[model samples]
Target: MSDPVLVIGAGVAGMTAAVELADNGVQVVLVDRKSTIGGNALNLYKAFPTDDCFYCFEGNRWRPGIRKCFYRSAMIDQPNIELMTNTIIQDISGTPSKFTVKLVIGPQYVDPKKCIMCGLCVEVSEAFALESPQCQPQAVTYDPSKLDEGAKKAEQDCPTKAISLDANPSEKTITVSDIVLATGYHEMQPVAVDEYGYGVLQNVITQLELARILDPNGPLGGRLVRPSDGREAKRIMMIQCVGSRDENYYPFCSKICCVFALKHANIIANERADGRVSVVYMDIRTYDRHERYYREAREAGVEFVRGRISRVVSTEDDTLEITVYDSLLDKYLRFSIDLLVLSSALEPPEGLDEIIKTLGLKTASGYVGPADAASEDEVVVGEHVYACGGVLGPAEIPESVNQARAVVSKILQGRK
Candidate 1:
């Protein structure tokens, strides 16, 4: 048998590629640095276009048109695919198809197979907590730093004997026939952008943080409340292009921010009771089929301000007073809101630079670039090396999945 294909970053894109390749009888090693696999998609409350569950993926060929929950997919039981969580690439050597990759695998404090989602550990120890209700592995995660007597007692009393406080990190070297980089993007935290008062202000947050707040399974239990005083955030304001399309930060446009911001706005206006949303954007770029989001948001009574925020002040009553210069209306506008969300730029994940250098791959605006600029297959980054999803740049889930399929096609075609 040929060496298993190594797919890095077990986000939606990497998972899709790995699952597809495995279904086609190819062996795959799917690795993720996170304790679970979903990545940013796990936090996103709803996917645009379909507005369906973010975990919903195209089911197997036998069940076409059926959307299957990724958490319950073949990833866990698939014979051809090996799932590795809490793993990172330590080093890359050799070349192309014959590459030898060294991986440092973090210790698994809780055994997923034995875990029954009983929440026994969570109740006993602050150190042990479930990441999400839909988290893959369906187990509680443990933090060594938070270890206490309660943690020790919980480990001892674990019904399934899944808790292992003595677990240690391990390293392994493996050779692969092909390498696929799906190492996703990171949501920029606009702490440096003082004008928005992101870091210093309690109610100011990034889009992803707002996503968590809106998530039914999140800490706040889907209640849109102020972080300062835990009151309902009836009035919410979103600022677009927080760190994108600017000379000081990323110059390239983060293509999906506008659509998702509008997605949030529509949800607020239509779903939440007495909720009002106002968006401030230089330009609303909901390209292609996603234009409907902007339309729907407007139709749902969501306010749109074609301008930039000039000032943000935290009032004594824990509300935010914002000033905007409306370029379209040629006037300054002022408003007070309960929540201020910044649609910050999405950038390539950290540690991608080392991987790029190791693989001798090209880059575009800090994202993985096509090896041959003139080539039709943009996913191919180098000899026997390819990229998909957010690794190439900021992409929606569907686009990322399509790119994954393209990479899978290329690999399959090359083998024949």
Candidate 2:
């Protein structure tokens, strides 16, 4: 049997490469450290360009546009691709044409294919037996924890006999030729900055949390309200460049932040009829393909203040008082707001340094150094390794998918 190419990270670049290689009659093994595929992009509440719409957009908004899946389960459903979720490549080494990989596969009690998406397991277990408080709603997520009293009951309740409480598998290793690393980037925890008070202040939310609330399909269903008071917000302020462009935090500009802030402002306007939101930024870096999106946001009446926010304090009324220096006006202004959103910066994904170390890769200035001879537009590093999305650096959906297809073509050509 021919050796299969091992694509790590299961992100946009890796998925695209695997699909293209498999379509070319190359055996493909796709693995991700995460339990599911989507990488960071999947965890996101909504995608850009179309906002709440997930499926309508296809392809790169630029170039010969094509649709690419950024979500995990969606990628696994693709034909000609073998997705090994909850799998990690512990080590990788080989020749240019062939390689060897050691993979650790975590057990899945319930096969995702057999999952009927029925609520029966959760429904029955709750009444008949104590179940995991964190029992996932999806049928695909059968708890692997050792069987307790509650788990035993839930197992019997599975009409499909799909539940397996004691399904942990011992580690096994597999060898494959070639490797692609596409583990995505991580968001800098805004709380690291003492002043932002992310965890300490309930009303002071990270950008991602705000995204969830703004997302129509998110936890709040596009409703903009104070998590603290559950009341309609009268005034909201967004603190931009938090953990970004500062020597103390991150010394680089997180490319997508400006548009994301704009998107948040748009969400605020769309959700609150009487609320006013202001974004405080050093300068809006709506670069590359995000220009149009920035313009669209301005037309929607989102206020953008070019300034540097200095401090934030809770007022007597529980409102947040933000002090900023407006560059245009050359004046300092203090505003009281009901909610404060911090547009935090991007960091290397969780455990990225470890993964890079395992793969003998390097990162500089908080970015994984691209493969030798790699260009700004290319995501493929070697014969089988590819990276897309923010893993390559701060990129929007369009750039990520664009690099994904480019890497896909390179993988396909190599298979020939």
Candidate 3:
């Protein structure tokens, strides 16, 4: 019997679709290039609109019977689902009902069957520890090039000898009835936007990097300190649409940058209470029920500057000096800030061009658009292939999950 469905890119969107299908007695093959499932989500500290915690977790880590995070464990526990990590989809052939996919599966470093979650290896060599939260299989791969005396000691200390120095990658094929392409997105490089002085200014960082700074498990331990110096950011300036909504670079609106900057401003207000946070944007784009966030942000003393930044220059003191053309005031204003955060644009995930060309899908603004968005109002790219999340276009967490479920509904309805 052939597998019921193949879900590519195991992010939240793909995970939701896989779980829904498997729960309804459909066999699913979830594949991703990363060792972990959560995509851009891992880089985020809090989501927009409600600003809820990004990764929902409960119970103690040491407890044996404690309930684990649903997103982290559900797919692994589901008997009908096969979680394949470190996989590369080389080819996709055939059509609607019987799709043949060629895959190159790479080793996970350690043998999952023999290894227990003992911290022996991690303690021996800190390099063995993976940075990702809720990593599936929970084993670190051994790299011969990076190995040292500590890694050798850990290998000898392993009771099960699950650490393998030589593991060969292999090729395989899986046939599935349906294919859902939920490949998320990649942050457009900020260096492309010249005016923002991304590469020129030392204190400048992207919005995604700001999210990492806010994350408790991030490099700074969630302290929100300036990269140039270990000082708390007292005067922070967030410039929106650095690479987005620009004629020179990406001309499309990145939908989420406006509100994403707003959320960060709110966090700074709450954290410091007196932290001077200013957002420089062409215009705010909080629509529908999320308007409350805008109101709350204003109430919390987050300054919204209506303008476009002309240039950012680095000072001799290692600070950033921003020159903005304020639309509201009809004048240029110069300000010095400790940190300059760029709200960069979101682009399609890497290698999506090959998949798009191979599948013969339509593109909108360099993104995978629906085959018939006007009539179908769906992300259906081809007969049996569908696209969602950031792959379809730049989408937030809520929109991506919603679109994923909608695609599954259409898939299941067709089966009926």
Tens-digit per-residue lDDT, 288-362, candidate 1: 999999888999999999999999999999899999999999999999999999999998899999899988999
TM-score of every prediction relative to native: 0.97, 0.85, 0.91
Q: In lDDT terms, how accurate is model 1?
A: 0.90
Candidate 2's TM-score: 0.85
Query: lDDT of all the models against the reference?
Result: 0.90, 0.67, 0.80
- Prediction RMSDs, each to the true structure: 1.5, 4.5, 3.3
- Writing each residue's lDDT as its tens digit, candidate 3 over 1-416 gives 54579999888788878877887788999999877677787678888644655566331234344354565577778898998888989999987789899988986567766777576887887547655445565565555567667887887898889876557888989888888998888888788677777877768989989899887778778887888877887889998887788788789988888778888888888876468888998878876677777888899888888988887888887788888889999999999898999999887778999988988989888888888878665678888888778888888888888888888888888787
Deviation (Å) of 53 in candidate 3? 1.6
**Alpha-carbon runs more than 4 Å astray in model 3:** 57-68, 112-119, 123-126, 141-147
Q: Residue 102 in candidate 1 has what lDDT?
A: 96
Quick one: best lDDT, which candidate? 1
Clash count per candidate: 0, 5, 0
- Alpha-carbon lDDT of model 2: 0.67
